[model samples]
Target: MSVTDTEATGRAPGGGAGPEPAVLTRRLRLVLVLLLTTQFMLAVDFAILNVALPVIGRGLGFPLAHLQWIGTSFALCAAGFTLLFGRVADLFGRRRLFLGGLVVLGVSSLVGGLAQSPGMLIVARVCQGLATAAVTPAALSLMTTSFPEGPLRRKALGLNGALMSSGFTTGAVLGGVLTDLLSWRWAFFINVPVALAVLVIAPRVIEESRPEKRPELDVPGAVSVTLGLLAVVFGLTQAGEQGWSSPGALLSLVAGVVLLVVFYFVERKVAAPLVPLGVLGKRSVAWGNVAGLFAFATFTSLVFPLTLYLQDVLGFSALVAGLSLGFLGLGTVTGGVTASRVIGRFGTRTTLLLGGSLQAVFTAALVCLGADRSWMWLMLFAGFAGGIGNMLAIVGFMVTATSGLADHEQGLATGLATMTQQVGITLGTPVMSAAATTAMTGSGAVAVLGGLKGAIGVNAALVLLGVLSSALFLRDDRPAALRASRRSGHGRSARRKGGGRFRPVA
Candidate 1:
């Protein structure tokens, strides 16, 4: 059957109605491209400004204290509203939210590019971030639901995860190139065309989707979660840059913990929870997220040790050290491109185990590549292996986590998955730095390299915990919605077939 004909006949992709694998549709391919671009855009913007921060501050005369806002403004808002916007998409329509987010993003980019003042630029950045928060999971959920649960879906997701994973690394390089070649403003201005192009193509290719029953916003849960997450993220960033014991960081961390605890209880009682607490109990979702968190934490943290080793020990210039990260970027995209096939061969459990094991071994191997060895060869090898392992684990976890969720809940699923990841990367840098500091008890190159090796070793050991966790806990199941709506219990036949427990999905 022709793809358009199937759509006309009302066979939804990955819905209860299901998509047929054999049909290749032009519209579907375009939709996937548009959605993957959206993911890459969201990922890239995060780091695009890193290299341009000095210029931005000088251009707009931002005070030293306020300079960090260039990055934090967008990130904090994106992190805070991601889950809420995901729920918003489910309740309304994913396409509707996605398009609206595009408008916001494009507008914000334009404003940011033209900004005459720091406040204006910051405001634009926040808006851009909010738009990213709105679009990221909405687009992802749209893509996931539009593809069937076989090779096609895996391929699309693997690519999405790849672009998303490498977005930051790519941005770091692109930021330098653009800033040196053109101007820092190009970073913000560049997004405008991408958004415009996506806007032009999206409606023709993508379909709209929302829950059958409209859902009400859980205001309490939303407010608490946003504040709680923002605080936690801010604290982590502060700790990473400053110190764990910094008063501001400690206070924010404490406040975040309290708010999250309150949010947990608040969710249980809310008539319509932002995240159905039971969703956390889903073994696939829980363990997949846990695995992703650990994998990302280890992979990102390695950057610190590697960067330090390259510069301090090898006496490379800043540009050379930065260029060396190309290997990591190469591996990340390579892994993303290959993740699906690996998963296909090994299954989610086996793939995750392999990823964790590789990450551990690669991280530990860094310890032996001291001043005596060729830093270039060892670093490249570590980056290649780390990137492969991290991306492979990411693909497995993403597929597993979203498995069995009701069609509408896919946004929430993606949001949670993304949130866990942001938190891990946020916390990882500080933890790694602290570990390195503790390891260096003496003075000179011996002490510094010793600390570097010690930190890498410790990080490697920590990764093993995630491996063990996945081995013990990661498993798959048919979502409760496969048979019935656990919330309404309305379908008499579905209810009879599916009680509280989920059956296995083939």
Candidate 2:
């Protein structure tokens, strides 16, 4: 068998002793559950704190202005350290790093739950962010490695995407309920048990993965990229609060851009760059990330305005508002499960276009929202539609990004895919909030409604741009030989199974 055949069949090159098919299948299922649960926990953390922010501020004596830092600190560290840790995981050991990350996340959540001062909570959040940076890529790499790129991989990724989306929405709901019933601290405490369970179970189920040839760390590349991302996330956070033209935002953004450029140059010169320039050359890696960025930016941003509309205009309590979004969460689940089949039938590109279009249309429907009670059902319908479309786009983008990469390179690909997603999530709300804030005409609820409509319109437009990028630039660029080998493997597998095969690219 050729190298391609070994990969396509998910078997040893020489038919050496391996686990029985039934045993292997069961193990894969266990691994998927473990990884997907972790993904959900991390995703929940992203939004859980947001709903509890005001309460936390009051409890910790945080000033109104500094409250955003509680969230920003996590985003900053998570985005900054993600790529470096991604490479570290690939070189060191994925399972080892994954376990370490879970420990960090648990400890941080404990500290956060027990925090007495604003500074302490903020510090804990930063640690949690760092933990997330470590866990996400490592977990993603594990999934890609455990499941060969075919129906199984697509199905795993689809569920991963669904849980990720739903988890964030679910976090909003849980945040409200936990805060109202127990305390805001429970929001932080909830993660501890989940992390502990995973830590105990993960080592037994997940085998470690590392590159066959370990290279020396690219210390310079790591420092530059990490700092550059930090600066960028800081600048974006500042832009959301202060105007983009403010001196601090301006300086941070410029410094970030320059540092990123420097990192690019460093990569070109280094023997073993943290992110190999060659990986970026793949069409899937480049364009797929672009699609992922927009998919997240629009979908995540839409939530902010919707939350505001519910609380400010519709006179809903935070808990009520969060509960109402149950429809949105359900839609994401539906879309995520449906995407794998869609990809198998129409391919990732078509899925991308279809998802983006539907997302835009649903988002645009929000423009009709009003202060009347009649608008509630429309809001739910639009949220459901938007959620479905958003998940489909995200899953398609991830599948596209990770496809056509070698097992060793899966870490880098997932890291890049995940980094873009974090950046998009970080970017979306601030930009949309800034736009809405600027469009606000007065201090009344009416003014807020107008601003929200404008933001939703901007959200629709951004998603449309994502669709255009997909239509114009995205294409399957896998090597012909690799593609041929995959087709042959699929043919044999399908024949043996009597007819179920998944083809995700044209």
Q: Largest TM-score belongs to which candidate?
A: 2
Expressed as tens digits, the lDDT of each residue in 1-506 for candidate 1 is 22342462235443456545655466777778889988898888987897789888888899988898887778788877888888888888998999999999999999999999999999999999899889988998887778767677788889988888788678877888888889999999999999999999888767787877797899999999999999998988888767899999999999999999999999999989999989988888888899988887887778778778877878776557667877787887888899888877667787788878887888778888767546678888888888888788888888888877877788899888778767777777788898889898788777788889888988898789989999999863324453345457655554467884445569
Estimate the overall C-alpha local distance difference test score of candidate 1. 0.82
Clashing pairs in 1: none
Q: Which residue pairs overlap in candidate 2's backbone?
A: none
Show the lowest summed lDDT stretch of 10 residues, model 1.
1-10
lDDT of each: 0.82, 0.88
Task: Please give, for residues 1-506, the per-residue lDDT of candidate 2 as tens digits.
Answer: 11222342365644332332323355577789999999999999999988888888888899998898988999999998998888888899888999999999999999999999988998899999999999999999988877776667788899999999999899999988898889999999999999999998888777777876798999999999999999999999899888888999989999999999999999999999999998998888899999999999989878899989999998998888888888889989999999988887677888898999999999999999998768999999989988899999999999999998887788888889889989999899988998798788988899999999989999999999999999999984444554676777865675567656545557
Q: What is the TM-score of each candidate against the true structure?
A: 0.89, 0.91
Query: Candidate 2, which ten residues in sequence have the lowest lDDT sum?
Result: 1-10
